[model samples]
Target: MSFKQLLYILLFFFTVSAKGSFILIPMDETTQQNHLKAYGITYWALDKQYKISWLLNYRGGSFLLPDAQEIRKECQIRGVSFEVLSDGESNSILDEISSPSQNMEAVVLERTPKIAVYTPKGKQPWDDAVTLVLTYAEIPFTPVYDEEVLSDGLLLYDWLHLHHEDFTGQYGKFFGAYKNAPWYIEQKKNAEALAAKLGYGKVSESKLA
Candidate 1:
């Protein structure tokens, strides 16, 4: 082939490859390698002020992120499965989703939501499941208790997890059963201490506060 023809062919291939400039994080069960880390990565990107599009009902609600080198590195580090798509391919997918016949929508997410877990700060006999999951997923959340709630500290968070909580001020109805248990006694002691700190004479009053 002529030298000029060879140069033109190479440039054509380069242009085609350069068009693939978006990352598609697939959440479908068949393709997703790590479901938990995928969510964490999305949250991480959002926290970094990167705009992400949530593809609702599309390939199990995938996430579309800008094709940044750091994002690719993050996906690899977190073991999250993803695909690279050309601009044309990405637009085609969006168009398909925009069709009324398809049960899908693209939501642009720009804000990082602040999450709070409503639970005691004192050490407990057991760990909260929601907190465990959040920890594993690498998501950060604030731990709030009755004192914080009473003081209107909840206003600082966008989402709140009840975290195996109780109401009616009965302390999970533990008085009749296992009240003498060391863990139960310690738990009650902490509750009373918190109630006192909140200027309540009784735990029930603190709960109601």
Candidate 2:
């Protein structure tokens, strides 16, 4: 065979072998990885980029939920990892949380507030406060109502709090204040529906407050 043909064959072999080495293709849009690396955002890993990966208890990709959901889908598609990073709202004041070395293993906190307080029991705005605090403190937590908490029974978490919640049944204040907003309306309906499903008694002002 000619020297040129032999050289071409050798180059082809090397290219095939090198393909696996360059696995990750960084995206142009702002990603959680970019934020974590550039701005120090906390995050948990979803897939293995290498032999080792990390996981976090509470995961938020970006301050914007849509953006976060997009990143999650992208990571899953790439077979890279679905990492949950604190969106930097509540977790801002809290100490920086690290990723777990194991892929599935993670540190998480489940925030369970009584439904009556969040729903009909009392309208103290504690639920919103908890969410705001979690966002600001950059802490990751799963918000659960009484039924979910009782049924799921709290699995993983280093710490837990009641968030100064009320179970009297006042309903969250945001529902009234932000009724025009889609998210607010949806949240209110969902809460009411959930309460009914759990057989929390008839929804009423006197019972909630």
Candidate 3:
């Protein structure tokens, strides 16, 4: 073949390859090439005439809500950070997940104290438990104490937890506890005051139970 013809063929091939070429670019802005900065492309395919939208990590259905795992997956896909949500009773799953990450000082911001205790017969336990636990765990908690429920010996700490003790001063039980115990009367007044102070409205023993 003539030299000019060979040169023309090479040019033709290069042109075609450039037109159909595929380039993978890093997603970060700092690392992307200058020319590609204004031309970044994310290609999504249309499956059918009608687009079917499916949740990336969540279960898209009735009668069920996506769990923490699904939430985590969705957060990753959407470039979002996730914070553990709790309703104040149980959070064992969060504890397990955070355990592994606990070693990283950067990720460990603040530790919230969780107070769990058993109520014994007739009275409340030590208020110092909160201070002691917080001192050791390096966490902060607001202790709750009631004069009606806890005698002078008892002290309020971290956050107050109402045991089987009836705040209504009713008795150990509800409606039943209120029927005759003087402690029940003082308990009701004290619980009301504490609830008001804590921004929770007055709740009866039944409501608490």
Q: Which tens-of-lDDT digit does each residue in 95-187 have in candidate 2?
A: 333333423232332222222212223333443675554444333455545554656445544345665443554444555577789866665
- Top lDDT model: 1
lDDT for predicted candidate 1 compared with the true structure: 0.88
The Cα RMSD in angstroms, rounded to one decimal, for candidate 1 relative to the true structure is 3.0
Instruction: Please write out the lDDT profile of model 3 over residues 118-202, one tens digit for every residue.
Output: 3433343243454444334333334334422334323333344544544453334554546456776775566566556545554
Model 1 Cα shift for residue 25 (angstroms): 0.9
lDDT by residue (130-202, candidate 1, tens digit) is 8887887898988888878987999999999896566767677567888889998889889888889889898
Angstrom error of the Cα, residue 189, model 2: value is 5.6
Worst 10 residues of 2 by lDDT: 38-47
The CA lDDT of each predicted structure is 0.88, 0.40, 0.35
Which regions of candidate 1 are displaced past 4 Å?
A: 1-19, 123-126, 173-177
**Residue 155, candidate 2: alpha-carbon lDDT:** 52
Higher-scoring candidate on lDDT, 2 or 3:
2
Q: Rank the candidates by TM-score, best first.
A: 1, 2, 3
